[model samples]
Target: MTSVSSPLQRLADALRKDTVGGFLLISAAVLALVLANSPAAGAYNAVREFVIGPSAPLHLDLSIGTWAADGLLAVFFFIVGAELKQEFVHGELRNPRRAVLPIVAAIGGMVVPALLFVAFNLAHPDKIGGWGIPMATDIAFALAVLAIVGRGLPPALRTFLLTLAIVDDLGAITVIAVFYTDDLSFLYLIGAVVLLAVFGYLQQGRGLAGALDRSALPNWVVYVPLAVVIWAFMHESGVHATIAGVAMGMLMRSSTRDGEHESPLHHAEHMLRPWAMGLALPIFALFSAGVSFSGFGTMLTDTVSLGIIVGLILGKLIGILGSAWLTTKLTAAELNPSLAWSDITGMSLLAGIGFTVSLLISELAYPAGTVLEHAKGGVLLASFTASVLASGILLRRSAHYRKKGVPAETAGRE
Candidate 1:
């Protein structure tokens, strides 16, 4: 670890120690499903559709579900952005040599899954918008499973999976901003750019730091209003408002003085990670994961649904594993000696757990109705299947290492 004490790294360590965050997310999703299926279905529907704001100048009036997706989810994206910036500035991404393998694998993971989705949806042009649905890796769920099942694996394996996921998230965000946007609003876009620039400038300079209380400078005076303005303008720009979080995060300064104080980016990530995992993400899951069992049969049989499933499960497996193997063979790079080929294989399988972003993209791709319901069902089922398979492999591998009193590297060789 660097002397500066990156908050992103601290947050990751904290999350790794506390696996309950992933379970809470799963519980929220399961509870939503139960509510949607039982006699409470009507009440669940009402709650989801309940409106709570005036529809006017801001157009902020939105359903409970929309609020979860657009508003709460932006917080989650902000955390991701901050963590990404930290990684680029002070973490593994700063080194091209260290980053190349995971970056290549992540790109392969995305492209193959999308191609597989397109394969299934090519005939159905109406559903083609969803090709990006399966190209995601839910880091929380995947890492939780690995932490529990692959604890005996080398630590490097975790770093590999985390790096790949970061890249995977960046890809998903790009796809959302580029492929799923609506009517253009360049005026708002330009204004958003200027606001973001101002925010960046303020963050970079320390002239105003002495004017405010040390604690209030980053959170109150600099970030709050600028973030709001950026988000509002981003929303009006016909782009998903979540992108504002990513943009702001990337622009945040990660390098700090004295190797003791946290950078503004690190501070933001630390503060937001808990909120994102505990509140924002779980709320998003509760609102988005409720798919009526009415579409269960159709989702299993539908081409669009099958596309999502195959893309996530099989495409991710082949893409990540194949690309990783190819990278090692093509270059001097080798799998981390602390890890095993089996570890990579298991991690690749876990990458198929594309619950969060998959559901979000499904919503953007399909309108409210049966098609959307079926897509949600597919995402749930596919994520469950991936989790089960990955757990089985990882647990077996962990046991193998534990019994031998050695890392899986030697075990795999034997």
Candidate 2:
């Protein structure tokens, strides 16, 4: 890894990142949305909803939800958690000073959305439980947008957004654990902690370098089984199942400025994305996105779910825009130069694309009835609106930046 090879390797890695993995993910997401809106939607729903395996036969019981949540999502979180740890340890976010912009933005983003959601619920106190529905960042779509633009923005902008989204997820995970527990089950929680600690020790030792190499493709294997154990413990221990994603991601691996492409840990993260996207996310989305249009007209007027709608759309704009403005105003550091205040504002609006988080919160808060149905509507509307608006703004801004001779994407300020 000489300095000479490093730059070439990075460029190669970036190209690899975009071509294979990126293409697969984008294809999956696009296919999902299209299929959802297509006449074949019924078939899509049936496939995702279908439960497989025997009833305690060999005790290998699993549902559509179980495979997605317990199986594939575990891998997604494991990768995210690994990235989170790496950033803190060695990436751009290694220093508090470097991290402040995105950190403050993330905090404000989380806080304002939650407050707005709570306000919506409070106005119709019956729905107050649905407060956490508007608190997530859809990283894939965001990254895909950056990739699509091709030029005009600096690389730093994408990096900043990526870091911010990861932090935002960390916060959302915390909210789920604190607000959404079904039971104390202290004993189960204890089991989770013990499992967590065992993984921690393994990670600290780099999970016995050689054993990992022989068993897995690379020598740094620790994240996968550890994530599985954590999921089992976390689920049985009274925590929402997905918290396992958050927890495992946090403790998965040490960061490597060395760029451990062959490291088993990194290898696992790479391998897992397809499973998470092609399998887990699509499965989850298929099951969750179906909203019966029965009495559909009246549901729109219903305040509880409608409030969810207003809160997400309105709240996302305010929090993301206002906080970003405040950060620029109060600090010497500025927005990515290729991006205007307008661009950031538009991106903020897109931050309202709160589909996954909203769905998870809805699951925790209201498991039944028209209110949940409404909340579903609210998420769809808000996310759809936010994504379109953000995309529009980004395209417009990219044009402006290009006129001034900036790359459309890739974060080059000069």
Best by lDDT: 1
lDDT of each residue in 265-343, candidate 2, tens digit only: 4655665655654455554544544544444567678765666666666776777677767887887646654455676
Residues 229-278 of candidate 1: C-alpha lDDT, one tens digit per residue: 79888877766677788788889878775443877777778777777877
Residue-pair clashes per candidate, as listed?
0, 14
Error of 1 at 32 (Å): 1.3
Off by over 4 Å in 1: 1-17, 54-56, 121-129, 147-152, 206-219, 258-260, 331-337, 367-370, 400-414
347: Cα error in model 2, Å: 2.6
Who wins the TM-score comparison? Answer: 1
How many times do residue backbones clash in model 2? 14
| Alpha carbon deviation, residue 149, candidate 1 (Å) | 3.7
Candidate 1: residue 303 lDDT (0-100): 84
Worst 10 residues of 1 by lDDT: 209-218
TM-score of 2: 0.76
